[model samples]
Target: MHKSRTNFVFGEGDKNASLLLIGEAPGAQEDLEGRPFVGRSGKLLDKILKAIDRDRFNDTYICNILKCRPPENRNPSLSEIDECKPYLNHQIKLINPKLIVTLGLVAASTLLGKDSSLKDMRNNIFYYMNYPVLVTYHPAFLLRSPSFKRNAWEDFKRIRDYIKD
Candidate 1:
């Protein structure tokens, strides 16, 4: 997979941050730039962070479950997730964030190790490696279904409150 990928979009932001945001995978723009969350979804994510008084550059770390983009922006296969999880795990170990915000179903499921609907996961906090994890809609999903923005905002508020503690 790495052999076919243009670049490995590991992550970006404060290395010592106490907040970590995990997304599903990189998109075309992210792949091209060799960075995570640089496209439209990323732009919305920046807004979400700003609303919470957080920014990737200073207070939070951002990363994806898969280091590389899947073909056609498809959902990552179980095998692909299995292969890439260790890298994400290592990142968590290194960052040791006090709070983790999963940006989509894929991220929430992968980090939580459970298969469930996004609705089932949202508005709740789960534990991943003992770190508090909050599940929310992916920015891409919110872009497509603006109705869910309210829900996503609710999740972000939980994150903001958690970090404030």
Candidate 2:
């Protein structure tokens, strides 16, 4: 996969952050820059964090389930996810965040192993390897469906509350 890509976005942010955000996979801009959440979605994410009084740079460890981007920004295959999960798990272990937030259905499904709709998943707390997981709408989704912004904000407030605890 590395042969087909420009860079490996292993993720970035505070190593000791108490909050960790996991997305589905890297997008084109993220792949081009070898950085997580650096595109328009990322900018929206920044604003979302600010609304909750959190910062990705100083407070949260932001990463994706698959470090490498899929060809054409397609959804990841099961094999790809299987191959990449260990790396993500290793990162989670190292960060040991108090809460793990999954942005969008793919992420929530991948980690929580639930096929429930995003609406059903939102605001509900699940567990992955003993870490608490909260499901929410992705920033990109919020960009497309502006109505969901309120829901995402609510989820972030829940995230803030968890970190506070």
Candidate 3:
């Protein structure tokens, strides 16, 4: 685990968090803060989670495919995710969460093992290693396109519904 990246931390809250959020990589704020989801996107994510009656800081196990932040927030290269996959896999095994939510294209692509548009990816739940995965637009995208908030909200509701079921 230590071999992965320096800016990595286990999710907050209970060690047995039921939800896991897998992201692409740490942003500048995440790298500097040594925490996942601390920047603008993180803030927006918090709101989404709150809307669904979940608290990211206390309910979801948040992580990235790559622990290290890519230069200038660039997308993580395939090799990087490959190198860091074991750590993520280990975390997933240890946490064994019931629901896994993937944020952004890179994380979703890595999890799904395919490249697809975010528009086509959302609106449905997929299975990976038997765990339910819900893919949604990254909060950064919502920041760029506020109109997508409705779609994001719909996804969040789906997550909430999954939890209920």
TM-score of each: 0.96, 0.97, 0.91
The sequence of per-residue lDDT tens digits that candidate 3 reaches over residues 1-165 is 234445664344445778888888887788777888899998998888888887865657788887777776677777877988898888888888889999888888889886789899888788887899999988888899999999889888888888777
lDDT of 1 by residue, 106-153 (tens): 898889988899999877779998988988899999999999999888
Residue 124, model 2: lDDT of 80
Error of 1 at 148 (Å): 0.7
Poorest 10 consecutive residues by lDDT, candidate 1: 1-10
Candidate 1, which segments miss by more than 4 Å at Cα? Answer: none
User: Which candidate, 1 or 3, has the higher lDDT?
Assistant: 1
* Residues 34-137 of candidate 2: C-alpha lDDT, one tens digit per residue: 99999999999989888888788887889999999898889999899999999999999999989999998889999988889999988688999999999999
Candidate 3 overall lDDT versus native? 0.81
Q: What would you estimate as the lDDT of candidate 2? A: 0.90
lDDT score of residue 132 within candidate 3: 90
User: Each prediction's Cα RMSD?
Assistant: 1.0, 0.8, 2.4
Which runs in model 3 stand beyond 4 Å of their true positions? Answer: 1-6, 9-13
Scanning candidate 2 in windows of ten residues, the lowest lDDT window is 50-59
Candidate 2 lDDT at 35 equals: 96
